[model samples]
Target: MYPSSALGEFLRSRRARLQPEELGLPGGVRRRRVAGLRREELAPLAGVSVGYYIRLEQGQAPNVSDEVLDALARTLRLDADERRHLHRLARIPQAQTSLPPTEVLRPGLSHMVEAFTDAPAIAVGRRGDILAWNPLAHALLAPHWPVMPTGRPPNFVRIDFLELAFARSLYADWAAKARDDVAYLQVSVSNFPGDEQLLAFIAELKELSPEFRELWAEHPVSNCATIAREYRHPQVGAMTLAAELLRPPDDEGQGVTVFQAEPGSVSQDRLRRLAELTSGSAA
Candidate 1:
């Protein structure tokens, strides 16, 4: 979808989720044809004209002021991330810059991953490509696939959506994870519109996976930094771990994701067991 349409859809979706009563507005005696606050009802509350609000929601408003955007965000009760996304969508001069090529993990980053002997750590590029990963991460995320050399990268998006059986076996909530991946991709595409590799990757995914096509149409945008993910491992059974995403300084679009379990928990015990199994297999 175009950025303007995305902005409109996001506004409509958020507006539809709020109730008149929740906004401290009296529910009128008249029967409502649509859900949530009407444009006229919301306009006054946001200190904007009904005509202007309608134009904004219809993606026809040009050069929307930051004051108006912030007012709308507050009126809609948007969370921090959602508010940022709204600003990105509504801002004028939506400049598109070509992103740099994928980066390999620096030596210090490789060392950092190695230090996490008990945790699974991987370095990922902008387009969800696995740039470098520690042995534990390899065992956790892709034991079947060989770890490639520095220049070549393995992509998480392809493996998750295109390889259904593997993805279903790996993630306990495969559908949710898949949707998150697609949503992240959508946000990435919006941010880096001039990235040819990203465009090609998305085109390839859309052509290959009908499921991806359906999810992409929903226009979900998210930048999830931490997630509680469940993995069904052949050696360690079911384990729930918190995946933390860390972007290294000056790494551009690359990020280091580390998965860890609570100390002294059953998940931790499983992780330790998995580490031992991976070590033994390597030996």
Candidate 2:
């Protein structure tokens, strides 16, 4: 389902976003009947026939080649992530069968999370579940986590975009961040066509939020590495935190996103003090 229908949807989404004028085509010649670029127009741009593009979108075509996929991605102005997704969909030699359900975090990973004292670290599964976190992680991400206890593994994607109050209070640039996170998740989902939770999550998000629906239609892949996020903390007031993501070699889905402040800065000092006050309080 992922590498098959998802590719079609992804391509269609990209085509729907651009205007004739944006693509340097005549805009006022005739009243457009459709919502997005026409198949004929896109076919030429992608160096394919109208019938071929139509077949690809309709999932009637055979496996797409890398060269053709790259051309389509370039024509659609895809980013690094989007391009990779295009390749992924094209290169999946075997037809998609049924995918497995989500896997819960292991106990050893939970113990590792519990051992972290000052660092705000959490073990997130492939689908972005909270999985496990130390007290400091809970304290720092409390704004995003809501009242759901650590064991329940609250999903950050759902919390940020769906829960209006939590999103507005926790992140000033909520929409941008949410879109990035969504795109990231989409890329991950595309990578793992055998992930059932990924498919279900995409379906649910598409149904629930109009903004998410619109953005999902674009099919942009979110692969931006570094971002400075502004957090309006209840205790520390307002501070911009720079986040760095570290991926473990053994686990493809697991990664540690560590937050830090600028050197010799008050925010840094405050974070250090906060760590001192609350570090290693096992409860």
Instruction: Score residue 16 of candidate 1 by CA lDDT.
Output: 74
Q: What is the alpha-carbon lDDT for the whole of candidate 2?
A: 0.72
Note the Cα lDDT for every prediction shown. 0.82, 0.72
lDDT of 1 by residue, 1-283 (tens): 3554667777877887788999899989999897877888889999999999999988799789999999999999988877888887776245566656654556776677767877899877778988778888999998888866544577888899988999999999998899889877876666655677787888888899999988776656678689998999988899999999887767466678899999899999999999999899889
Checking candidate 2 for backbone clashes, the offending pairs are none
Q: Pick the candidate with the highest TM-score.
A: 2
Candidate 1 lDDT score relative to the true structure: 0.82
